[model samples]
Target: MPRYKLTIEYDGTPYAGWQRQAGLPSVQGVVETAIARFCSAEVTITTAGRTDAGVHASAQTVHVDLERDWPADKVRDALNAHLSQAGEAVSVLTAERVAQDFDARFSALRRHYLYRILNRRSPAALDARRVWWVPRPLDAEKMHEAAQRLIGYHDFTTFRATQCQAKSPLRSLDVLDVTRHGEMIEIRASARSFLHNQIRSFAGSLAEVGFGRWTADDLQAALEARDRARCGMVAPPYGLYLIGVDYA
Candidate 1:
């Protein structure tokens, strides 16, 4: 079997999520179907992250094992063709052969996520599904200060979702930054791996700090509490984007 890695981008508004569901359309199902069409085999694709519904990806990665060898560009073009027939939102940006030992999920060294917030009185129209809209102005500097407290290794139980399946609550957060560009608030976060809904939880809590409801010390206390209830809120899914992935 030949192993291939795929880099993908998609507007996830119309799909149920990255993982395939029984009846709901998903990113995985669409790509797998495309691979099957080209490779003439039942291929199982493994992804770097299983993003939730309404979450977007600018650079999602996946790996598949094909029964026969095919040129990288051919595979990319073929998958895009099938995806185009299926819908316009999903695309296989690139594909290439990789080592047989390369597992998309496990081989990943770091994953970067960006959460976008449109801060203004007006409701979002052109990119409604791509960002979270907050009518009230946010203090991005305060949010950044609060986020710094979350850096380094710690028990992230407060930020982890109740339904999170990670075996342990301990994880190292490499970066957490908050910045504003006009009406757009951008949050950049990176870690080796994230628990389910962890980023959203972090963003929500920080947004509270940005709105003057929480402070940097409060965020520290929440982490020290190591309780999910101590967290601020779980931000909306529309704002989240899987922006980058680094492999070792």
Candidate 2:
């Protein structure tokens, strides 16, 4: 068997998510279907991350093994052609033969996520589904300042999902920065692995600081409390994107 690695990009608006579920449309399901069409065999693909419903990915990585040896370029082109024929929004950006030991998820060193907020008096028109429309004036600088409290190793219990299956709440968040580009406020988060809704929880809590409702001390307090009840709004999935994954 030959193993191949793939870099993928997708518009996640129409899919249930990156993971396949019975009778549900998913990025994985569509890509697997495309592969089956091109190769007439079932192959299990492993992804670096399982993005939630409505979340997008720009450089998602995955690996798969196939029965027949195929050129990397042919694999990319054939799968893409099949996906296009079916009108699926997923795309295989690159494909290369990799060693069998390269497990996409386990081998990932870090994952980067971007959350976008539209800070204006009116709703987003062009990038409606791509950004979170916040019709109030936001202080991106304050959000950045408050986000610093979340950097480094900590128990992110307040920012994690109640149903998160991770054994521990401790996660080393390498980066959490907020910046503004005109009317758009961007929040970037990087970590080895993230708890469910972790970034979204941060976004929601930080937005309070941006809106003058919470102080930097309050953000710190939330973290130290280590209670889910202290967490604020969870940003919507559409505003979140798995920008890239790193391996080392």
Candidate 3:
């Protein structure tokens, strides 16, 4: 068998997240269906990250094993052709043959995410569903300053979803930066893994600082509390994106 790695991008607006469900549409289901159409095989693929519904991806990584060897470009173009024919908002950006020992999910070294916020009184004219719109003014600097408090290893119980299956809440977050670009506030996070909803949890709480509702000290207090009840909010999934993945 030959293994091929795929880099994918999708709108994530009309599907029920990355994992395949019994009947609901999913990124995995759509891609697998496209593969089946192209190769007529029942194949399974694993992703570096499984995003939630409405959570877009610009550079998601997945790997699949095929019994018959095929050209990487052919695999990419064929799956994309099938996906386009089906009107799916997904694309196979690139495909490369990899060693059998390479595992897309487990071999990942780092995962990066970006969350966008439209900060203005005016509603999103064309960027709706791609950003979180905050009508009030936000202090991006304050949000950035507050975000640093969450940089190192910590018990992120306050940020973890109640239903999170991660065995422990201890994880090291390598990067968390907030930057402003005109009307957009971008939150970038990088880590080997994240507790479910951790980034969104941070965004929701950081929004408080940006909105003048909470101070840096308050944000730090929430982290120290380590209680989910103390967490501020979970930002909407539409604004969150799995931006990239790194492998060694």
CA lDDT, candidate 1, residue 183: 95
lDDT of 1: 0.93
TM-score: model 2 vs. ground truth:
0.98
Name the regions of candidate 2 deviating beyond 4 angstroms.
Answer: none
Model 2 residue 134 distance off true place after TM-score fit, in angstroms:
0.4
Q: Rate the local accuracy (lDDT) of all candidates.
A: 0.93, 0.93, 0.95
Q: Write the per-residue lDDT of candidate 2 for residues 89-170, one digit (tens) a residue.
A: 8999999998888888999999999999999999989997899999988899999999999999999999999999899999
TM-score of each: 0.98, 0.98, 0.99
Candidates sorted on lDDT, descending: 3, 2, 1
Task: Give per-residue CA lDDT, model 1, range 149-179, as digits (tens).
Answer: 9999999999998988999999999999999
lDDT of 3: 0.95
**Tens-digit lDDT string for candidate 3 (1-248):** 99999999999999999999998999999999999888898999999988999999999999999888999999999999999999999999999999999999999999999999999999997998999999999999999999999999999999989999999999899999999999999999999998999999999999999989999999999999999999998999999999999999
Top model by lDDT, which number? 3
